[model samples]
Target: MALVLAAQRGRCCLWALRRQRWNQVQRFVKWASTIGGHNIGKILIANRGEIACRVMRTAKKMGVKSVAVYSEADRNSMHVAMADEAYCIGPAPSQQSYLAMEKIMQVAKVSAAQAIHPGYGFLSENTEFAELCKQEGIIFIGPPSSAIRDMGIKSTSKAIMSAAGVPVVEGYHGEDQSDECLKEHAKRIGYPVMIKAVRGGGGKGMRIAHSEKEFLDQLESARREAKKSFNDDAVLIEKFVDNPRHVEVQVFGDQHGNAVYLFERDCSVQRRHQKIIEEAPGPGINPEVRRRLGEAAVKAAKAVNYVGAGTVEFIMDSKHNFYFMEMNTRLQVEHPVTEMITGTDLVEWQLRVAAGEKIPLMQEDIVLQGHAFEARIYAEDPNNNFMPGAGPLLHLTTPPPDSFTRIETGVRQGDEVSVHYDPMIAKLVVWAEDRQAALRKLRYSLHQYNIVGLSTNIDFLLSLSGHPQFEAGNVHTNFIPQHHDELFPTKKATPHEVMCQAALGLILKEKMLTDAFRDQSDDKFSPFASSTGRRINICYTRKLSLLDGENIVDVAVSYNQEGSYKMQIQDETFLISGEIFNEGDSVYLRSSVNGTVCKSKLVILDNTIYLFFPEGSAQIGLPVPKYLSAVSSVVMQSGAVAPMTGTVEKVFVKAGDKVKIGDPLMVMIAMKMEHTIRAPKAGVIKKVNFQEGAQANRHAPLVEFVDEEAESK
Candidate 1:
């Protein structure tokens, strides 16, 4: 009893000390502000989507009026609905709306906004915009314009960090664009070097040069992308940090020359340099390393007299050595994880700090509580190379009983997933006592998440969360590509599982027939009679299996409504609705099988289904009957097409242009990656549908692939 009392006293003492330290930091931050009261009023948010909604939530909590500026495409957006007042800025394209400095400023003035909060993207990092706000006497709820300017250029930021005694990856940030110069730098830094654009972000204008041959090809590609993206052909070469963990520290500063770090977040789980999953209190970082990282981040922030919220990103090697990468002088997409663990509303802090209020907490007062994880749910198809998917979102439902896990979504059911901007559908965040617990929560939440009418990467995220290495907290930069086969294994289900599914389908079909008969007549029919009667017809189809065998199964299905279907085999009947496929054709099922019933989750390829069985799991291809067509136009047209997912850097043929076989049609840019579309056969461009800057969907026609030769002949 005495020992327990002592332990409790010790914990109380620690809590008091933490509070005391926070008070000191707060005192220092608010030394000047204490003379005045908190007076920040109306704030204009210059962005769209969930981020705008997220900032508005904090503003409402602080009793501050938030005015949202939206584009024509976002007039019905959730952010616009959440704001105290909303106004239209421009058309759908980002440049004319969210990125328009004059329009945003004009809206702020008209709305009587005293402060402007640029959330994450768009004009968030535009130093010119920040300076304009400062000149207009409007508080920019972000870092100083000078800080943004200094960090906007990768070369200058690296120089700044290096001067501040922060380790930086050895590279050539010089302005020389000669191939010889780049080759020499690459050789000196080693073969596996990364080429990047100085004025670009979001993984754009970046390429990995592994060998001599790859160097030349990547150099040209990088230049082309840089020229098109930032209108700057200058590139920087840096040594690739092999097997590195991407970790960043969130820091805040005040005009009183005081700053504090909020620990670190692990953002190594990325796709094409864009983080997909992030977690607070980085998985493998220990206390000592955390302290060093935090101090370094604070020093970097202090070097530029940074005010407001900013993040200092670093790449840590296997040996725990880290190098400063870049600083993002804006609120990050993954800031919710930090908020969950620290109990601090960063947007509120930004407002308070911008109002000349000091940070009320000291570094020592900032206590690391539990672990938190964030997953970016995007309207993208992971199986289709992470292409941006677009269509009317028929359904957008999140996991129920939002406990420690929180969902932040901008679009609801009936909303359109347009190709006008980023494909981030929502952000799902979960918190727990530790990393493993957080992972478990995240996995469960992902499993329960459902988004229909458009493809998404939810299943991929679930698989990544459940990955052995990821759960073990041992993943690095190349984790995805290294384990691609294992992560997305290609295997066929056992014959017995197939038989069980068939049996279940049969049973379901019999039940449906009996139900229909009973509904039509007063008398009920037995299950045995229905199964034995010639009234029921079974269809069989043969498909190639992954295991070098053939799969044959009987498909029995019925329609509950237009475009909605239910398939039955034996005792198991799978309920499938939304976007129906070919009539009476065998379709692959990707589902989680429980006992005699298999739940259809994600439909993989047209013919492949991921199935969860009672005993184990398997992938089974549904057999298409011999009477059915090998290729069904119904199934092909039913699938959602990718639009504006890729960067259309160039459109070779214009409308009514004469062309030949396999001529380059257009290009699509996505996730900073580029893909080229070509003509199918010899033909004249009947109609060039898309323009250079206009984005295209997967099935959206780029150009008519008519056979010109055939027409001539």
Candidate 2:
């Protein structure tokens, strides 16, 4: 009994001593920052994309030199150019480059940087990487390694929240991860349970099993995704919530047990469990509920001794009851909206705090300024179920910057949206006096934004902004599904006026090329000068095709002298005249039709033309003549072909393996999403053309199938 008392006394003394030291450090930082900016001499950013660029801007403002590390694919990225010094860490694939801990550390040491800032994704929340920085005596511009470990694992975080008196849904988080154990838990939780991988983020490795019959299959899929994404397949089961809003509170803490909440953000607008749009001061939340949420968040942060910026997420029911979900111990993607409303630069605070600075403002000093919204712009086709897209940015434009508008992007007009990284192009943030005004600005900005060569969700975004239900703030996790028809209206046939604009675009492109050639030649007059119109009185026909759903409409164009053309569709004909003007990376085409002059922004990419106006856009294609189409057999339905350019990840069947309808053939991964190719019909796999880990072209054959009759013979 005496020994036990003595040991307890010793432990109390050690805790008191450590607490004293932490308080001293906190006091020093708070004093130093107010007098002058905390000086971090130099820092290296160990990530890529817009978030990396965002950190560098703040670092420069703080008088700190910045270093950048990039994969071979990102060698020419904007972040690399923005940094004072840059280095290529490894090859294009992320594992060999951006996620290579040793390479990132080596660059930091070589550049003599005093700290490393991991921008959101890649290695931002990796506790092992944070520990490596501590061992090297280099500061990590994020929460401490201890905090990362505690909050990164979903099971551990839930347990900690429960101990702190925070409400958490029933979930099985255990050491025994056998399939049998998980099955038993699912049965207890009842049907429609949520199976989530404990070590995963970004909505990966999460699945919903609605019945016992489908539980095992979904569990296996979730495990595979988890293992491939996070290198950990352990999972936890929880009761799924219906009609829940994803609300999260921002919190900050220091070494001296000082913590404050920075209001809340409504991230209920999501797809694939990833946020698409986010707003500050979550809609419909009252003062009392907000206060309770803030208190809960602060408590959660203090439980982990969290330092730096973090978000404590919750799932709120329709009646305003909220439950703790998990904590993200790093910067979040939708942070810009928070900054807009709070009038604070979260990135700047991160830099100062990492350099031993403290929170500059107390709880009373922080106030919400106005309403703000952030819309993520992605290269995807809304018509194709929002599948990710990759291509060159043949044409690009964005809303002009102002006090109420902010455009955050890491790629330029001519850059390529590679298949190896996220397809997000930019974040469009708007601020205003109220929600209605902010939404109006969001709609205007969406109309102003434009892209070519690949499809984007700009039109869909505009539709969503004008949605009557959305305008009334009727939002939830399942909002999109409930309003799918209104958000994505059916595509209609192209108008004749639009086809005329496309013809004008093609003519303008030819004229520019000819003019360029003439200027490069020594002789002022070249024989290949741009043709003004069809030769004298002769008329020539050109065919134009526009894609709508699964079919194509062909329109005929007849050219006459002096920039005149006639577009005809079976029984209808429209005589059109247009003039085009070129401006900084954009072309404006003015078309005169039906005694009205309509102007449109034009973009011509190879054989395609895009016309952007006030309402939306139209894609026009220069179709090949029927004679050439017959000779060039570009599409083969019988052969398993890649839908986009990517690296093949797996082949389930080998040469001569028999396959039936809907059987798995291969897995093709691109832009960080996986697509499995299935056999279309019963047949024998005559040839597995490409091996695993091989590069594939768009629509290139992967496996060739011989007819069953031919195989039998």
Candidate 3:
């Protein structure tokens, strides 16, 4: 006890010293920033989620106050809590909240903020919003309005790039946006043409039509999404580069007419035309090619007289030949990877440059250091075509963060991944001395990220990172689909040993609870109240039912007097013994299965058992009662249901409308992407449960259907 007390005292002293050091660092930063010449003292972050919190971190470091404007849905978000002042702009929708330019501007004025930082997405690339800031005498921490205007529109940017002698893809950028005109241009460009919105970024309004037959439908889909996201429906048809790699360079400029490039990042692997993983500097890019890419990006920035942080994107074919795609007129979602490689805080640079400072480091002064990788962790089901999900983040745990690794996030454990906005949860970024080491660190970190509430692509990211071709740096835009077979292999039954582990976890947990209850009562040593399956003389046998997906497995356990047990599953028996212990609010199981001992993090929530090991994880479900299962099945089989929670954008059928299988019934928008709910069979619509603009939850019946023959009868 004396030694323990001494150790505790030492820890307390260590903590105090660390706190003192941190205070010293903060004071030093404040003094240094005070010496820097900048008039803006406070800035309003006209955004939400991770980016807002990210900007606040740099702002706090610089001793600048930050004001956060959030929607009603983000009342309890981390960004709101971190801000010096927070205001609710409007309701949950983007139009009423984050994208409401006047409302945000009003908050900036009310809060006495001198600047507004539109942290990407909503108004980051908005030309009018930048112009509004200029008119209001408030600094917009981005490029000039003219630069945003030139680069925000793809046609204008392409023309500027061409005039700047940069290579551009063949596309139709004319003002004629008629269906006939766009179709004709697409035909001239050849089939497999790319339909993209003129004012689109982040793949929100982009589609590839593989053939002429699907061109019109794809065009209409892209236009609708573009209209909803950017409020513009004009599209440009371009030649789709088959299996091209997406590479982009990060460029920073100042009002003093100085610009520099922070190298390039490879964002080739994607889904739904959006990037999943990004790395820098681009793999397999030699020194000469890298120099050319950076120079081209710098030329593009200079052509527009760009300012602040921006990304110049390119599409590279197999021969390493590349063409300009489009320039993002603001800090990108994947800027952390570039920051990690270059050892620079891009957001801090944005603030300083926006304050009329010259480029901190010139082109020759900047240097690249290590390799970095950033994986976007999102709330989506990889098995269900990556459909986005919205729910509470019930149990969230992450790898220990260090200088080499970072978990950039906005939501806490109880916060919901809202249905009204993007489903991204966090970004996992890591850095190392080389590409191979960085890739290994990424996989290691992913294995430690465990989530229980909603479906995530963590496991899928592991598979993709470890794939052979990915390791060889042979990645393209079609990496996921091209390697689908290996990435998504056939599911097999739960291994018997794993099943034994699950059963042991359940039994041990029960024993712990029973012991706790007995200890609290007068009958502390009552064997009758114990749930350990202990018998007086003979072994006690009990049957356990566990669900793996839709299949149920039966396990027979015989408890021995020696505290070990024999679990039998389909003619195989194993000796298992385990104990449940608590370690810092988390429950863990240490089990010896057939003389092999292993430990795993055990989470039993909502009738499911999650076992997270060092290398892999397993999910076992508790069988639902028969009555409850029957009720759910009936509700599910009633009619076609919403695949996810979303707002109904368009409904094609009312009551009594007839439709066949695969017929488009309605269009729903969720997570800024469009999805079409189709008919499951030929039937007459009995009821239209959801109307246009109505929000529908997952598995809710959208359109009740009855068979035509049954209706006639």
Candidate 4:
């Protein structure tokens, strides 16, 4: 009566054990009869973006129709289109839409949904939300409300882990949240302690204090972030682990008290305490240690009666000593890598367990497969310290998904990556025969990914994948800091070859247009756009202006004959030749600059040209004459401007406030990361132009500075 693989059994006892699945099915039927006398019929996903889509796919695969709820901003979203039915919740802001529990429940009830799958973030771990779903007679596709309550708070979870015989990091998880009390606890825990939000995950509301002098400030920052993100300022302290690897075990459980561990994933290579890349099988893990970790995770799950997909995260040191970090009581962002290695659909498992069914596979039946890795593609500029960018995705290209690779995304070309949500564009996953093969596939895939319109971290991801240390698998949580230089080398100046290519492309384009008009014009004395609609002479002596960050280059192209031109950069001259073709919105250029032939995918939008090749990318801006573009230019600022487009969240000073270098002046939040703007030098704040909660643009001055000499003048 049960459907399991033939490989699940190697002996008669195992077959006998599987036959007991009939009992599990009978138990589920009795329980279902008490509830609604059915399996999951119609389900509602109480979330948005890629996660919503992910849950819908699994639901459809199981013959269950899905409903979607969307805000005004997401009416045209991909998930809304993919769902069987959809309802509008509220405005764009999450508080009025995604987090509106009553509205979501109303929609679910009106749609006659039997279960609500709170996919990952919004209300997924909220105990009150889970309980309300149960009270409304709708299945909450997650752990019981009791488990969410215990593990949702860090302080309570640590106590629970300790009681369950799981190792915990030594620190204070107390009721007193006073600053002075927290400082004392940090002192006792010794310098370099981790101050974390009691209810935080995903790197928000976490800070590391190095010593006594900096502890209070760091604690306040952590609390502010926590309060803004989670509405709770409760925090806990922990002894900081040095260069520890972040490894987590994937665990599943059923209502029949059955639990199993899938495997472990190494998420050590992270930035800002959040994982950007992840892999499964946790390279170099001791077989015995892996056994212990799996046992411990299963034990932790049973202690809380966890029923669903959960991740038991741990911090392992260089000596392989591991401690419980926290347990995410839902599917994780990096769950795909685990799926790739185990050949398991974690979402399907979540659905079946939520329906009171037993796990299809046991620990012995689940065999590990090849290695896999996941790279999180974000709309961020890594060279600018990973400043998030929000805009339309003008051009998007990615490697075609195959058996060995998968692309998980929620947005399409021309969709706007809103600033209100996480700026992750997609997750690129790859698998190969082994770790080294997988690493090689990841690098090749990154090269195939080409994006334009907004800044992205594709180049940075490529650099990280190619780094010898990363390729060698010598990874840690502090891997970025350890190899920042190699990971993010200095942006080399635009090569003369590339600049020459740009000039040739522009010149050839102009000539092609002229020839086009000459051929199509009816009148002889005028161009196509003129009243005569006739051929007209077009100038070829045009300047190709290129700007790469602060460095700018200008080249002039002179026509020699048909399809030939001479390019001049500075005092040097080169016989540069090239051909450009316009295909859809992309520009392809094949040019010879100083005897080196180069071919590149080029994108020219307004005053900028983007070149993406196998080696790297080049963003060069074309500037008009000084007189033509004078009104649009900002006279160089002597003080700080908004580094990127963000909301001015806080203002610590006003006009006439004296500040020293490195003093915190304001806090600006963009793409979900808070960046504190500090005084650039010892000066007086001349004026604060933007008020709190105001939108600030990149290079828009927020604080004007005046030195003593300027004040005297």
Candidate 5:
């Protein structure tokens, strides 16, 4: 009866899916009318990666064609495959490719695309790009150039917000950018002020000086990053609201001068000042507060005659007193959370509004439905301050998508997460009836997202979402730092049972492969050809060494004649039996350890065994022999080393220069952020390994340090 009911339910789901697709087609047909009196048949996506794929998905659903402009590096990217037309503009560096406006415009002209969608990041909020689209007679599927200009500059946006009756943070948004003047203003505003570049967004060129002593250093760092990212280093000082919640309203405007907000998203949990997870219809907000947030956001939009999708960011205190932080004049990275609760396709709205149509739904017509969460999964080692990483996605598996779950991504399994772009692998989004349910769903979905290759933040995100404070929705920008101990608990050794399971998996996999080889060879059906470790009237023991991080564990497996085995780890021993099976595209291991049966997904790649159980995952490495390990390890002289792959932007010390501990050695730009390499100990610089604009791999020494005594000798 249960099987019958499940079959019926499956049919019902299929029917629902068919209906949804049909409805989408009907909606597209309706919107297929002329845009701005000219049929917008094709749109040129002026971006790359996930956002580009996101725009193309909507364009395809709307029955419109999409043209993708990619760098040479992205010639075979997923977005290129998805687009109706694709063109290679230039090489990998964004300045010559994705950010090259003239190349994109020429593609637009050549492709005869009626519009361009700057899908977040590069050229998304570029005022000049928006204006250039106008000059080229192409509809930029975003806000007006004037609006982008007004909001692109933090100082200008603050003045406009203040004039428009929006509560603005108290700070200096003045013309005097002198270090001394900014310092005086920071002193006036008080310590713990935010030093932000005027054109900063996505946490770039933003810093917090907790006290007056570090104000100048923080300011200079922010200026350098600002200059690198925006080509403008002018900064604005704002009172950094301690323990504030980052809430932002999603507002949309049309050429008809009508606008509305889609409530708010609380991006309070952040690292390096960028949002890690986002949820919509902010956790503790009341209906009254929600209405006011929406109204204020709409007012800000109308103030600049904004069009298309825009996010108005606010810094809210415990008392719910909100102050304008800044405005992102393009679609936000976390926009899907807003869409989940509001049941709106914002990209479609962007396309429609850009075509000179009114917003499909007004303020009263829009209703917030359920709670949603978006957790950004990046290629980074969370234990190492979340420093970004780049490599191949050797194996990737995500939870099945449904009505309430989404995996927004651009790269696929076996694709490289390049060093030249943001390290985000995908955005895992989930929705449920309420906040707690949504939180639970988010955790469950995260557990199913399995990846094998370089380091990832998946385990860290799991730890974060399951934290007591985060589960209760009591989130703030400093939540991670405040709960560091709980979030980053001391490492524990791998459980004996898990290690046993890892050994069994390895044993079973090897036996299977050996059996396959024997079956294909002339030794087929030969008793001696079996590698099952079975000997006549004798038990064979095989010892294996596995590396867990830096520590190694030795496992002894004693094979029994009856196909079962006894595995010993340290002093613990367990009888284990397992058979590996190939299911669909995944490898599964059904193992009985001490008569406790369990199943786990197994993936072996790059000398590491990855075991994904229902609850969690484990990684066990096959230790390389000492001789090979020594040969592969690159030894470097005592010096400052790069934390990740990036370009050396500036070198502060020359060869033979004396430096104290913690002195700046050089600056590197990587994964769209700036990192300063500081001296490890007092020494004289023997040699500089890289100059400005030279690429450096992770852990590569930037400077060779010599001892003071040796230099004196």
Candidate 6:
């Protein structure tokens, strides 16, 4: 049956091709009527950040003047600087600027733009916005508003697919809101169902409920989150396919009723329901399945009269049965991989299609050239719950883009990674002949990339790329959390390594002091040493190393100015710049075993020298005649602190709020993102030092928690 359907579709496609060829004169006339041979003169972009910049790059290449709309916070953003003209839409919050349709339209009018390109997020998928563009007599460089409306709603899109004979995941997409109703639906569908917001993207307002209790509990939370994030609380329940591979087909269409599929991309590697990595030519998709997937996607696109470029996403189970997911109506972050494989510029096609031109390529012309992968490098700490890191990027560097690798970014050194935007620093993509080669190139690019003064997940990405299982391509959706222990081993530096570091620190200090004395010794004399032969004193202390197998090591060094020195271990001699001092108050020591060298700060207090290594202070008795006492005091403390450097989103606690354990005291929205901070324990909030829209540094205290004493019975 499938083969028969394929044959019919192929025949239809060929007939359409013949008709298109025969009607070239009529097609030319239609094209002239729509575009009038006038290329886009000016384009207004209704988005911000890297995506906006990405669109402008293509716009400029096509000789189109680009206009950028930005909020006050993004005045100096790269996108603003890249545009031929820029206008301030509103303040920092997106509600006033990016999502403000009136303001965006005003900018378009003021800029005299011939078209409006709603780059990815913001209002890209908003059917009303697209409709407004048409009403204003400006080209909307995307799918038709009708197509957007058709695919904008999950339930409606699934129904449309069902009508088109496309396979869809079994679930309930009705308007039922009752807990019992959803619970019944979950049971009918089976356990382990996915609750997703109908209007949500980017993994927001999605939850996985395993049982009846969980379904009820997660439903309200998902609704609330969906409302807050996307202003829509309506959700749909779908059957969760275990170990499913996320795949999507890129499709393009024109006004002449022609559409073509550009193969598929695998975006299965994800965290928190958001994709962190994506690749082209999915790892395990056989040739037969690939052909079917492409055909289905083409049918899906044709069902909606889709124009311009769009994506049809799917979830394929282990048995190779694929189910239709959602369709993205705009350009995707992972489009670079598809470009790498097909050598097609989707942005260019979007412009050409919007201008009423036919798709420039046919099915046979589209061919997968090689494997490609893209890793989204984010300003977040992988070691600390992936909390978004926001601060001024003090330094940024990466290798140049070549045939094998590409780096797409909108930031540079001295740029502020503000909390009002996504924390994605850049997208690192690599292309090679095969999957293994692509993975290797990705790992190399990640290692070579460097960003300072802000935490990033570069190290974590490198580790994941190089992991045995990941390299072998034998991973599932739950791979990260499942094998986190093995991938992220909890191994601290060995005692010998610490000792070696300490020795190196000492050597560096000695060299610095020696250089300082050589440059300015004539200006000032040392207080511990006279001009002749008086002794100098040094004191230093460092942290003790605790390693595996109960191994511990402490490093402390002290010296006096006199030429005579006392050694604790007579067999070991401290190497100080190739000089051996038999008797001296100032003695330099380097651990020969570990290659650690140190300069000591010797103090002649009660004939004892003190050693410090930025960790702690230690006292050493000089002259070999006194007993030694080593005491260590280490301090450990914790409280309400910012997990990462980000702008304060909201502070819920005040000077004296009684709070129970697990109560949310504050909410932080960073990198144009959001997170909640809960109470560590049952306590009274002593003080709240931050407010909404304030900058908070990493580890800075935002509130004080005073523990409540047990009441007397």
Two-way TM-score contest, 1 vs 3, winner: 3
For candidate 3, give the lDDT: 0.90
Please provide, for model 3 over 60-179, each residue's C-alpha lDDT reduced to its tens digit, 9 standing for 90 to 100: 988889999999999999999999999999999898899899999999999999899999899999999999999999999999999999998999999999999999999999999999
TM-score of each: 0.78, 0.88, 0.94, 0.89, 0.95, 0.77
lDDT of 6 by residue, 1-713 (tens): 99798667656644544454345435444543445365577889898877888888877766678999999998998999999999999998788889999999988998899888898888999999999989998999999998898898888999999999989999999987777888899999998999998887878788899887778767876786677677888899999998788889999989999999999998887887888888898887889999999999999999999998899999988787899999888888899899877766687678778877789788997767668999999988777778777788754667668855788888877898877778888899888767877887887677557565667887778777878877877656766887788767784544333333343433344445665675676645554223222235523322223222233344333332442222222234342222322223233333233234443322223333333332222333323222432222111133477776666766778866888878878877555456678887776776787898788876778787654443221
For candidate 1, the lDDT comes to 0.74
Which should have the higher lDDT, number 1 or number 5?
Answer: 5
Residue lDDT tens for model 2, 1-713: 99798667656644543454355447545554552444477889998989889888877765678999999999899999999999999999899999999999999999998889998878999999999999999989999998999898999999999999999988798878998999999899887888998987888789889999999978987887788778899899988888689999999887667889999999887777777888988888999999999999999999999988999999999988999888988999999888777667787777767767677567897777557899999998878777788889877899898866999889888899988899999999998756887898998888889887678878877887788987887778877877888887777777766766776677667877877887887875545664554444444777766543335666687776766777776677878777788766677888876557888888777667788887777887766577987887767766688878787777899987888889989877788776678887788888888888898988898889986567678
Q: For each candidate, what is the lDDT?
A: 0.74, 0.83, 0.90, 0.84, 0.90, 0.74
lDDT of 5 by residue, 121-171 (tens): 999999999999999889899999999999999999999999999999999
lDDT of 3 at 383: 93
**Counted clashes in each candidate structure:** 33, 0, 0, 2, 0, 36
The number of clashing residue pairs in model 5 is 0
Clashing pairs in 2: none
Better of 5 and 6 by TM-score: 5
lDDT of 1 by residue, 1-713 (tens): 99798667656744654564466456445443442354467899998888898888877756679999989988898999999999998998777898899999998889889999999878898888999998998888899889998887889999999999998999999978899999998998997999988876777788899987789878987888887666687889999988899999999999999999998999987887778989998887889999999999999999999999999999999988999988999989999898777767787778878988778577887877778999999988787667766777764556764546778877887888767778888999997756777788888788667665667888788778888999999978788888887677664546544544433433344455675776777544534344323243433221222321364554455544342335554466555432112222222233223334344333233444543332333455555565675544332221122345554677777756666655666666754357666566555555666678776655655666445455577
**TM-score of the candidate numbered 2?**
0.88
Please report the candidate that would top TM-score against the real structure: 5
Taking every candidate in turn, the Cα RMSD to the unseen true structure, in Å, is 7.9, 10.5, 6.2, 6.2, 3.7, 11.2
Model 4 alpha-carbon drift over 4 Å, by segment: 1-38, 511-520, 524-543, 556-587, 590-598, 634-639, 690-700, 706-710
Candidate 1 ranges beyond 4 A from true positions: 1-38, 401-403, 491-553, 556-647, 651-666, 670-673, 678-697, 700-713
